[model samples]
Target: MKDNAPVFDALDLDRHAFFFDFDGTLAEFTDDPADVALDARLGLDLMRLLRRTGGAVAILTGRHRAEILSHIDPAIPVAGLHGAEFPGEVLAHDPARRAQFSPLLPGLSALVAAFPGTLLEEKDAGFALHWRRAPQHEQAMIAAAERALTELGPDWVIQHGKFVAELRQSGGDKGSALRRFMAEPPFAGRLPVAFGDDLNDMPMLAAARELGGLAVAMGERDLPADHRLSGPRALAEWLERGLA
Candidate 1:
């Protein structure tokens, strides 16, 4: 959260489509994921941005769409489970994919059970093992994710975040989601502006730049971006400036 990143100019609401990452970008990190909350003021700001941009705002998150809704307004469009879930698009491989993951659940549960502070989060395409409450178990969680990947075969991969490791299907990511969103109404024909704070967000950031738009890095992840801000507070202030 160092303030080393310079502030950039306000976005032109009419021409730019905004894509945001939730945790570590819009909201601060929490020991317990269930305790994470979206700031009411930021939610209102997002609603205003949506209005100003002709609804060109969306969230691309690792959380499930339903789970994300518990924190934010359901009116805002969200591509959840790292884009595995989209608005009204039923994935043909969903059931098959879920079945593949079902068998691994018992083993994963047993793994976390050995680590008192670790938690398992099941998602549409896969699952995540969080070690935030038990940093000492980080390596074990990662190894577990790697082992799960082997069992799931080439179609699956491991995604490492701040204090968590996830095992999910390969291909469906924030970048793909961004590209898909850019092809649709309200998002099409506009420059993409992505904001993120971690390794998992690199694809989305790269996509924004590849699409001839801005990539804003939040926090100190050393991410390649056109602009950067310290963290969520800085982002909130930056959004306020854009609104002004």
Candidate 2:
């Protein structure tokens, strides 16, 4: 990572498409994922950037599109479930594949029940074991997710974040999602600038840089990026500067 990065500005916005990760990037982490709220000021700035960029802004997140929509303008495009889902994209998995998760749930549920403060987040495409409030159970959570993946077979994979581990289908990832978005209207032909804060965000960050654009890492996690921001509050302030 470079110590000095160019100051973000409207000029950069004019030719670059903006991509952001939600938790820990746009909003701070909360013990309850459901309680993490987007800052109103940050939302407004994002909307303004979207408009200024001629609809070139999109959020690529591990969250479901609807969940992100609840916090921001529904008009802005969101690629959710770590790129497993997109606007107007229909996903149909084989019955056998769908049934695979069924076997994992009961065990995962039992584990969560056994550990106080740990959470199990069920998404449309996958599920995650979060130990944000129960740090001592982190290894247990990861082990459970790994076991779930093993049972699910080669079709499934694991995604690790700060205090969570997810087991989902193997095909889609943040980098692939970023490339897909950049191939479409209002996004194609524009530079890509991605902002993220966790391991899940790594692929998206690398994709942006590989595309001859910029990657802004949020907080510290040894992520490679063109620049870095302290955290979500600093990111919000950085966006404010671009608006000026």
Highest lDDT: which candidate? 1
Write down the lDDT that model 2 would get: 0.87
- lDDT (tens digit, per residue) of candidate 2 on 40-69: 999999999889899998999998888899
> Lowest summed-lDDT stretch of 10 residues in model 2?
1-10
For model 1 the local lDDT of residue 142 reads 89
Candidate whose TM-score is highest:
2
Instruction: For candidate 2, list the clashing residue pairs, or say none.
Output: none
| Candidate 1 worst ten-residue window by lDDT | 1-10
TM-score of 2: 0.94
